[model samples]
Target: MNWTDSLEIAIALDEAHPDISPLTVGFVDLREMVMALAEFEDEAEKSGEKILEAIQMNWIEERE
Candidate 1:
């Protein structure tokens, strides 16, 4: 999924890291984790703080 696919990425992250807390994760770690996902396929350099924040927010919502 691309950077714009926040819900899909969040779902993947939730399933991949059920025990981890998204709220405690830093943007750097979060980006790495997203890049590591098998389904993720996007330009590495395309991600910006805004997209990362959206993904993080979605992940937090997924947890709740």
Candidate 2:
């Protein structure tokens, strides 16, 4: 998924890191985790604070 697919990325992250809290993750680590996903296929340089925040928010929602 691309940088714009925040919800999808969040879902994948939630599944991949079931024990970790998205709220505690910093943008740097979060971006790394997202880039590591098997389904993720986007340029690392494309990610920014806003995209990361959206992914984090979606991940928080996914957990709830």
Top-scoring candidate (TM-score): 2
lDDT of 2: 0.97
lDDT of 2 by residue, 1-64 (tens): 9999999999999999999999899999999999999999999999999999999999999999
Q: Per the 3 Å backbone cut-off, how many clashing residue pairs does candidate 2 have?
A: 0
lDDT of each: 0.95, 0.97
Clashes of 1: 0
Worst 10 residues of 1 by lDDT: 43-52
TM for candidate 1 is 0.96
lDDT of 1 by residue, 9-51 (tens): 9999999999999999998999999999999999889999999
Model 1 residue runs over 4 Å out of place are none
Q: What is the lDDT of residue 54 in candidate 1?
A: 96
lDDT of 1 at 10: 95
* Alpha-carbon shift of residue 38 in model 2 (angstroms): 0.4
